[model samples]
Target: MATQDTSTSTQLSPEALEGALAPLTAALGDRLLTPPADGFAETAAVFLGGPERIPVAVARVRTTDEVAAVVAVARDANLPLAVRSGGHSFARHGLADGGLVLDMRLMDGIEIDADAGVGHAQGGVLAGTYSTAAGEHGLATGFGDTGTVGITGLALGGGIGYLSRLHGLTADNLLGAEVVLADGRVVQANADENPDLFWALRGGGGNFGVVTRLDLRLRELPVVTGGMVAWPAEPGTLATVLATLAEAPEKLSGMVNVMTAPPLPMLPAEVHGKPIVMALVCFAGPASEAEAVFAPLRALGTVFDGVSEIPYPEMFVAGGPEGGASADARPGFLGEGVWAPDEAWAAAAIEAVSSAQHGLAVVNLRPMGGAIAGVDPAATAFAHRDAAWMVTVQGMALGLDGVPALREWVASTSGTLGVAGRGYVNFMANATPQDVSDAYPEATLARLREVKRAYDPTNLFAANHNVAP
Candidate 1:
């Protein structure tokens, strides 16, 4: 528990603020930034469009000891502290309102041991960095869709990507982590050391401590058959896409998006700004079988087909679709098997997107359950193993004026299609206590709370989807 002498408010008095910031400034020099600093704006930016947050200060630390120093300062000051890695959090947990932030970007480092089939990644390492390093050794770890996302946050929230069906989740591949506890003590968590803390860290978010580094398990995957395949949106398009994915082997995984096609050079001019069903797929099996694996999708009348054998790292080179500067996203698990009357669901999604006048709206559906379901629910903090589809409805606009309508569209569409379950923590921004409760099962939440009690009883680390102690 935090000491009684520690101040519990983020807004410090002028004298208290000066006293609290002086030590960090003296120790870190220019690395410690206050408002109006040259790089403060860039360092404080959030990835997915959320309300802007101005942290009281930002510290760019290089080593684990430096991280501990920052944590200790924040602890003694009783100021809210947040960690920034890739800064891709939809909820923008990386930024603190009138609090301190540890900018871990300078800690980026990665070491690959091909012989041991493992990779050690610093908390600041991005998915692209780790994947590129591992790809050199014909190895890879399962991470989320985007390359710019910080690998640690993604892994902590149960990473799901093209390789998920083949290699389970990023959390499944986690072998160990080096963390700085709420009390400013540095420790290691793994199967044989601090086992309970390790279990909670796998999918419990950054509630217990500040993770400085991660030890990840890697698989030998030199290349894959992966790329985008799109077709004109139709009543039956979504069903065909999902049914094909369901029948696919574990080696194949894909994400389907129902949205208005943007004007890209590769796409026909006529298809631009028109509704379409686009599928981004990856097959990790034998390259020779790639064509056969994708034959069914081809039969659906593709307007564009870019699928082909390529180095696994190449898939992330271009990244995914562009998101609005400010966006609203709702992600949830689709239980009861792909929503009954697939055609109706598909039609509703298409209609919603087509009628949206303010901003871009998309209905995303990714098939779950292959190696993902093979893990028992009790094995980790992420409990949605039996789900068939991971669904998210999102909309983005230039300003706040267009937000209300987008929100209405998202809520209505989600209700119509039935996207109710423990929501995906990583995609949820501005989540409430009930949202946190809904993200975990009762037993899982209880166990997480126990770990929380043992590790962070006073809740010093409450920036994320907190599991209250």
Candidate 2:
């Protein structure tokens, strides 16, 4: 559905592109799609949508061989190739402007080895699908907060979620991977084989290759005490909730977001559009003690409470924003710890939200410790193990016209909150080279670059958070 802008000099020559796609056409047949195809838009619709999110061509592959074939064709043509799993790239990197896209959705498959407590999942598996499969066996793996997020992307970028403190990051659970390298060679990566690539694959963005399948470590998590609870976002309410969460036990992991209440059916109509502090928490310990662990937060006077013992997968489908909303956000790690907000900090944040009268604004804070910090910083590609919190300054507008103002508000709010240094790569959008530099330390980046050189020296996989050779 996305037509090339012929007027832009940056546009690829349509005739040349068509010629380059000939090999894939012969190989994939009807599985390959170009613009204006009946199902192209549906196949390319990722988390964020627009003309930019549409690629010149899409290849829907059902098997690893097909993926390798497509990758070989793309490399031979020297065409930029984007890979799509759950299609949630914050910067829309999953779709290429004038290149081919490898649609991995059809490859979705999960085989849970309950006896060994491991999950063998294809790269295309979504968080919810994997969780549901694992939940059947009283086992689970930590992905991000969203059900639709790709397990491969989340794990590769250091996934943090409700069970993060209990089970560690999703990357921490990754035991091995089947990667298709730049040269079209399919190889395995893990502690025992290709250890360097295996280390890079963990918490390293999609830089080295296209992962075909992953071996993830699962935890025993049949049911957890988890759900959303909220309080009116009065002045300093954000600060109080954050401080409380920071002091809570490691078994209790909370993701707190400050935003104006929407007109959801469960919420009282009177509170609609009013600022509120909402938190989604999970207690992995005894269900009976969930009440005690959350007592400190409940004492803050909750306006709504939905916390209860439930199936692990249920947490992903709980109340959330409607799909298709466009967000302008800045992600950062606050190594200094929770916001020790003064009166000024609270006022600035409140005003930032108020300015988005017709849109949506959110300040999300997730404290870090426990199993996440227990891992050595240099153990994997995710080096920010000592960070105290993960923060995102986000604003969602209804239309494109409101995005610019929202971006300004996000910048201003981020400055006020003092969000500095490297951020969680998964949350970064429209990141610059400087941003990439911030995401990794000098030693880690140097090592990653060396690996990039060894495997993908030509940089065939440059669409993701790139570590150039």
Candidate 3:
């Protein structure tokens, strides 16, 4: 549980306020957002849904200098600060209770150096934006599945996506990062420059500093073949699919979703409200080659097959809901490698899906192998290099009253899958220290702690999956 400071009334000195706002307003011009400003509430509402928190101020910084100025003010005033890029954080960590909320959404800039095969993305760029820009140049970088996910948060937390099996985790492609330390000092971290900080930022989960920009290595990705295939959800189907997926070629990557079929126009009407397995897939090779690769899956008797040759940008379209008040979700990593499946695991998954009373219960299984598994576990802060799949159980009800029951059902169902200890940072709702520790090995945790001490000695950036300084 998070300890809250319950003192009702707290104030900052007038001089501190003047000192903080003066230079920030001057440097950012009209980007600074005070409580009374237009769009202040909307800016605060971007990344949050369950609880409403009104910050003292929301500073929409456009550049690194503005970020430094905002940090300096927060430091001088002794106020907690929240950093937000795309504002899609699952735990609402991007919104401060009563402190400053630093909005980085205005910094969406992408520069791709095709000759060098590298791309520089500003903090606010979403995964979709970056992918589209890179696709124009016949280049690509690994990012999370969702288009709305910020590059800053996803890269820092070990990005797993369709391309992960072919290229690598997003952190693995990270060449460098421009970060503003807790003390408002701007620094560049990479293999040769501030190497320790660079290692920690890879999978450290935004604890060391606020990343202003990222330099990512790009891959040659002009076109790829991928999409979703939906099948009737039966008792033994899930187990059979998992067993087959474990043996599929690493060139083909995908995710399996067990959920109540939505009333979408593309889905067959008979499948609505019925249990279904929607497997989102991606292949990095040519269309003909991909067709050959996916032929085995096509033989599985899917109700609807939308899989075909498509542009890489279409991959982000597979992600589900971004913001809503009536959803309860828990993202976790399964521990066991791709071993033989059992009836128990399949039974639990079916029961969870069948027992969903209110709205929908989904078991999302994302494939993990190829380049992601090839990287050494010690190379970056993302320690789960060997896990076979990342699973998330989500239930969305009609009202707030259903939140507890939904959350409880998700927890209980996840436990029955037999791999509940490891948790994914991006999917974490409101996790404890034990949950965070379980995500990484002992050695990785120790190194992360040392790096945290060096970058944020006072633990000022303690919002997301914090590594205590």
Clash count list over all predictions: 1, 0, 0
Better of 1 and 3 by lDDT: 1
Candidates' TM-scores?
Answer: 0.95, 0.94, 0.94
**How many collisions between residues are there in candidate 2?**
0
Model 1 lDDT, full chain set = 0.83
Give lDDT tens digits, candidate 1, residues 128-186: 98999999998999897788889988989899898998789899899999999988889
Q: What is the lDDT of residue 161 in candidate 1?
A: 92
Q: Candidate 3: where is the Cα deviation over 4 Å?
A: 1-20, 318-322, 326-328, 335-337
Task: Report, for every candidate in turn, its global Cα lDDT versus the true structure.
Answer: 0.83, 0.81, 0.79
Best by TM-score: 1
Off by over 4 Å in 1: 1-9, 336-341
Pairs with steric clashes in candidate 2 = none
Q: Candidate 1: give the clashing pairs.
A: 91-429
True-vs-predicted CA distance for residue 243, candidate 3, Å: 2.5
Clashing pairs in 3: none
* Candidate 3 residue-wise lDDT, 203-240, digit = tens: 99889888999999999987788887888876577777
Residue range with the least summed lDDT across 10 consecutive positions in model 3 = 1-10
